[model samples]
Target chain A: MRKFTILAGLLLAVSLAQAQEYAPPKGDAHNGAALFQKFGCYSCHGSWGQGTGRDGPRLNPPPAFPVVLQQLRTPRREMPPYVASIIPDQGVADIYAYLSSLPKAPDPKSIKELQ
Target chain B: MSKRIKRRQFLAGVAAAGPAISLISTTGTAAAQTAPASSIPPVPNDERSLNDMPPQTQGKSGSDFMIDVIKTLDIDYCASLPGSTFRGLQESMINYGGNRKPEFITTLHEDSAAAMCHGYAKVAHKPMACMVHGTVGLQHASMAIYNAFADRVPMIVLTGNIGNSVTRQMNVEWNHSAQDQAITVRDFTKWDDQPQSLQAFADSMVRAYDLATTVPMAPVLITADGDLQEDTIPPGMEKKLYIPKLKMRGHPTGDPALVQDAAKMLVAAENPVIYVNRYARTDNGPALLVELAELLQAPVVDSHGRMNIANRHPLNHSPRREPTFANADVILALEPVDIWGLTNYVADLIGRPDLPPRRNPNLKIIHIGSEMLLTKSNFQDSQRYAQVDLSIAGDAESTMPSLIEAVKSQITAAHKSRFAARGQKLHEMSAKFLDAARQDVAYQWEARPISTGRMVMELWDQIRNEDWMMPTESQFISDWPFRLWDMNKPWHTMGGSGAQGIGYNTPAALGAALANKQHGRVTVAMVGDGDFNMAPGVLWTATHHQIPILYLVHNNRAYHQEVMMIVRMADRRMRSNSPNLYVGTKIEGPNIDYAKIAQGYGMYAEGPISDPKDLAAAIRRGVERVKRGEPALIDIVSEGR
Candidate 1:
């Protein structure tokens, strides 16, 4: 029983480690715009980080830069991973900064079509 | 001396020289040896030529008689783009046939003709005729034919072929003639035949129709010979022509013992899931499926190949397919295209597929469908083979009643109480998903470059009250309606383009609209821009026929799916700066004016509307225009999906 308890504790520790959050480095918005276009992130997320339905999710009001970096490292769904070897850590950071700095989409209610 | 040689002199010279002299001659010998002393070839007398011709009467043309047989089949329309090979039949259809029962509906392209027939068959639940111009036309129509075949929809394709080489005219006729035109599409169609004579044509036509309409149905081809269609009936030969009666074979039902066995399994299992695709043929199908599911209190996962069940049903588990399947001890698949894919979890990641996840190892799978009834050796649309405990080769809809009865018989009072409790739990889960979907729409509801979720909600608000039919599945706004809209009615959804061809949406929607027009159902479609560009001329046909469809262009300004794929490829190679990827994929820079094109086709047009707020108003106006029995189009500048 004591051994089983220790094993359970170890298992809990492994899961906690896996769930730990990533820390992102400081990035430049201007550099991020160039990286976003250069890395073809704009192809799916759109030129303005407004996601297309068939391609990717929206990122204008960017998620935590760390999460973005993690997504690029180990992607979900159909998105391909961009490892650090392929796209340097700085490139991903720059993309996140650009997305974070991008102008927010205007209210759909303000648009003549949405009402 | 006379320029024309006398027939008597020429004949005398030929007789004296013998036929060998003319045959042995190379250049001038044939003509010179056959010529008289005047140095001119003899012309045959009109009376002599008349004697050589077959004895004939002014009886009806063979094409007219062919139309008579087509009429007996109760075909409503014969869509075609005119070709010379079928000129005789076309003339007969318009004139002698009086064009009433099977009216000749002129389509702009052969693909449009086939696609129109496909959509019509889906709504009407009956196959219609499509005529094409010999080999060239059949080639054009092949893609749509494959689409119909994949979807299990019936269509009878009639293409003109010149069977006799001797009878064919020079140049154009030679180009049009084929030993067998149906060969191009035979692998895709249920059956194909090239009839040699008028009697054969009638028999083949009827047989093709019967084969196409049967369960596990697909498009069938009958290449009508130009000779058979154009030739005048010889004296007394008209009386000999016989038209055979068409026979529609019954749909196969599962063996009673097997159905009972399946029922027992379902009854014994702790959790059972039902998956459906291409299962609903008409309103009765969905009703029967609903009844069966409610009886068993099963969770239904609709693939939306057709509207197999109401999306808003309390037991719908479409959004939770993976979880529901994972939990299921017994899974019953109804006409699913890829049972193997459904049972296995495949990661899209590079090497992650090495260790694919599967459902419970001991899970029992019972597959009921007519997928085994008819199959082609090629095209691979049959999908991968799946291991099943029991496979029933029968039509899902036809087998549902027996299965329902069997399940009902096995249920006890205690079992009923248990099932009711289980059903109540499932109902709550379904409500939760629906609420979640509604909330998801509110996300970015007011974002510019409008969100697909928001777009769908706005459109739904306008058309929810009307009897609306959307006969398309747009990639730009996929599954929005399935999650948010009420689709209980038979004509509410008409499924996707089967072959995944680009040009199917615009014409197919028009075709469904044409069918709905007679029934007074308001037909609408959200078509992708890339698909619309493939055959925008279909708009002309809609205007000309006055097909009152409200067409909305989800113009993302690119072949966005291809762009995504290209980007993924680029990312894998670590080469992000590629102009070629964008060069072919992007449809922007000078954005296509779809509304203007619609206006050119004489349709009520609006937009390139990027603003989200204007969507509802534009859709409302378009719906109003549709209500007034006029075709309309609105172009929405949408973001890529």
Candidate 2:
């Protein structure tokens, strides 16, 4: 969900980055959803809060609201650049809310899940 | 009368009775969920609905449903060495992606995985995705990616990352990922992304594909985090995901003012020389470049990999960088890779095309390309190389056509050389070289083990006339058959020696062909079989796509170049006999049955062709299968035995 949010963020980046100050869309996941598809984000990222662990960055793993948003608003190199309206502030807030609703971080025992 | 017999045979075949198309495996995953709690594999009887995947509401995170998308995109298989970075996602890819879904091509070396992806892509036309193990995996695959990038192949890489240790608490997240991983491939990639959210992950997929497949195509990579790849989204988001239609930025044209100025300089020069690289990589680059040469009766050097113009054109000269410099009064470097090398050589010879490629006190040099000009000086203390006189870095493809129009507007048609004399000179010179080369023992450029020459000749004898997606190992092709194979059209053949990476033949070539298959051509890769075995897994990708291509395995049992080097070193060191000499470099014992391996992957296969006499016929047979719309392999076994 968060990966989709970031990807959706790229297609609409010009608008999202420029409209950082705009009002939130009514009842939208705002930051609860992060457009993940636009960046080829989830191709490597996980379907849920978990990142695929190689190329995809960690989405808000839990306490999801705004966590994924926080990471996207700031990123490392070689990312096709993104900003707020390209992803909207309200959309970010809604997606953040949506993500916060997902499962919490995996327990340390998750690696045990691999074998 | 024969028709009646054939019909009877056909009827008999039909009466033999075949089963209905069946699901290959309906429950690699679901059997664990439903199926009455049994260990048995799910039967094809149910005919699983791909639409039924992602059972819950897959609202924003489209990850769970991407398997269907991969199917829609026609990705038959992916050749990747598995890693924990993509563990969860890989689970979904296998368990859920379905029968025709891109299957995981297990591999040993990460580079082989990438190269396999490269090979598959050339023919698959769509990206046959390669997955890497975080930073280390990326680093290993970098060479193959570079080759894919340089060759302009469309590849999409899915890298599983363990997000920064401090950033996420996901289990084992610290063991993977590079801080700024995509930076490693920046020089050649079209686009890259590392989404921090599920929704964005899915959306960028469309964007990455669009960019990778755009004109002037190249691979694009996206880093997905292990944490992000498995996250579940809200309900039904799979249906909501949309791949945005992308509009490519077209090639830019020069201002009439700029074109006129450049053209004036070109026509007026006494000893003008043209330098071309990637332009010749494009179908138009060669034509436009040749037109300019014909108009000026000037010499052209092939920094451009393939010989666009006749090499023996009185104006056509060797592209070895130095002499190309001495003879030119004006220089135009089109799509140059080493701008520094070109400029330093032509500093006093040529000037700008958009501006001029020449440097120094006299010659005018123009640098025209879609990307910006980077002189070697960019690396060395930031000093501009003799500095380009005129530089236009947008759409050389379009710019040249217009310049042609402008030059035509001014220069008399009679000014164009009939080029008859020059053509003869080239033919004569080429024959002379081939004659001398056949005898030359210095470097043994003609030594056996499928002398790059023999390989090309065999390839030409086989597939020159049929439409082919030619993904050549950069060096081998340029040395020979470059004169031998005539590529007069865009996408006629795709190759990138620019980066000089091996293992690319398998994946990138296949990927590009996959993208262009509807364009209708047998995608052919003339690669050393050693390289073939390097990423043999890609064959499955090709098989799955049914992309017709002939993979000619130049099976020289040894890495011939290494043996040559070892011999050189031994002779130099005068170590009369080193048992270790050329020991590890060979693939001996019983030579590999590459034909069997190819057949195992579902392809028509032939060879271990030791005799050169068998080369043509075997090649013909292989070419026939490719024409029939199936991948085929010819293991042209050659070595100095």
Candidate 3:
């Protein structure tokens, strides 16, 4: 279950990378973890930002600060456009740092196919 | 919130004069029902109704009025589960839609609801309405919708929603609401609509009906805002709305000039062969295909499917038509997924994709199929088309007749010499393909862990000549046994992987079984264990309704594709390896007891078949139980990447 959570989180992380712009200013994983939980991001994205919310996409694929800034400005499809006003740069940075801190999702083969 | 749409405006909105009833109560069910054949009763049976709850303040659209609209569309039952967002709409449905307002057959989970719609529509061959509760509902529905998309089942899905303000502010509303609702189903639906105005809703709806019913049909979505369900127009607007009927069929008249030229090759080639597929179940495709085959007295190989030509037909050639295929100077492939398969499988003898596609130096090709423009929905790139000397695009039903006409126009008894020499030689080769395929099954059954080949062949002996539906999984148990199954068309094998979603087969098979319930078709959904584990709860739906579906769980453990990739990795890296591919891929420890799981959900269950030899009997048992009108499961334990 924990492994799946990590995987789901990583999925979101990957998508987040694609959905948002890149701007990792040497993010601090510890600070990122704090902000992620504080914002209730885990409720839907699982403990590490994998999807759990009925409709939330994964959040681990860390978007660099530029991508985060971009998401705030130019939103696509259904995701609401967020601005620095709604989520500050440092805060977004912290979340990104926290997600990047988690181990990348292990490939099924690397772990051994379930027997 | 405005409970009322100003009366005069409501009057203007209503295209017709006010009905006899002046009261707009959502709770007055009995009173609002249009007692006679017309949907909601215009005159309320005030005395017989539920007077305890006050009429809904938001108001009820004339129930009979809405019923009047639904009636025109020939809608019968509405499928749904409880949700506050749709309460007003349900009320309006009963009241306005009247007799046409489908009595909602609610289920526990939204997935089952979608599957029920799948099964229902398969049998009905038309769209059935199923409404879910906004964002969360749509999310839950994603898996089933994916299956439906893969199965190519047409459904009209409605979801309850609150506007953005409500989704943002109100807790009850926000959780279920989405800013862009259609995003949930964009990958699966043919079209989706979120009309802001009722007029737009109605208009988009008519368009939706048209699009969904067209060829290559699948489900379409339309979000019904909570606000719209109960909003009443004046009185008589139902008549102005119209939904179009779905239709598509095309024909290419074989040019008489080309026919003569092609006939010279076809009738003169001693080893001419005919390849057939999905055309068998089509309108006149089967008969016309048969006529052309009989004209040449050529053997027809059901290369991709079953019974395009009846197995017992005298002119029906045997399965070992390979030599005929090989020796023929010219071969005609009709509606085959393998016309390309043949040339590609023998590519080394010809050429590769990097260069221009080259066919066998000795063989000529005539290819006939419908579409040239392909979509990613099925992962088939349009550029992969085989290089054929003559590739005709038209309905197999349409083109077959024309080709048959051409064959009749030229071939004579003297032309018997055209087919005799190669026909005898080819007959021997078919026996080889058939013998090899059969031995292949035997060889697998003799192997250690469970083999998919033995599993399907054994299962076939159990359910042959019965109504069976297999979700076409690309790598799993799909093509290996295509040699044995009586497949006449694509529908015979429910190719439920167009979207290639992993967890789609279980629910989809459940749906197809449900659709086939009354017809006494024992629907079989052969799926990977991973696929089954994803939505095993659908078993409850089958149990709930006594739907007798033979849910075969191909429990080979692990994501085989990934495992294979890892093996390839080791091979590419020049490292000697063992099948440690079973690392995280196999299911073990508290390994799932699929039989217990099925029985837990009220299905008759069997297996964990340790021996491949018993695979046939286990499948037979599951089919027998389901044939008796109860759901059943057979979990086959196999070892594969």
Number of the top DockQ candidate:
1
DockQ, prediction 3: 0.01
- The candidate maximizing lDDT is 1
DockQ, candidate 1, comes to 0.27
What TM-score does structure 3 among the candidates reach? 0.65
Residue B21 of model 3 has an lDDT of 24
Say what the interface RMSD of candidate 3 is. Answer: 22.1
Best by TM-score: 1
- TM-scores of chain A across the candidates, in order, are 0.74, 0.47, 0.58
Between prediction 1 and prediction 2, the one with superior TM-score is 1
Give the candidate order by descending lDDT: 1, 3, 2
Ranking by DockQ, best first?
1, 3, 2
lDDT of 2 by residue, B405-497 (tens): 776676654445433344455445445443332221112122333344445566675676677657665353334444435555556554453
| DockQ of each candidate relative to the true complex | 0.27, 0.01, 0.01
Over B125-147, each residue of candidate 3 has an lDDT whose tens digit, in order, gives: 56677778788878888777766
Report how far off residue B274 is in candidate 1 (Å): 0.2
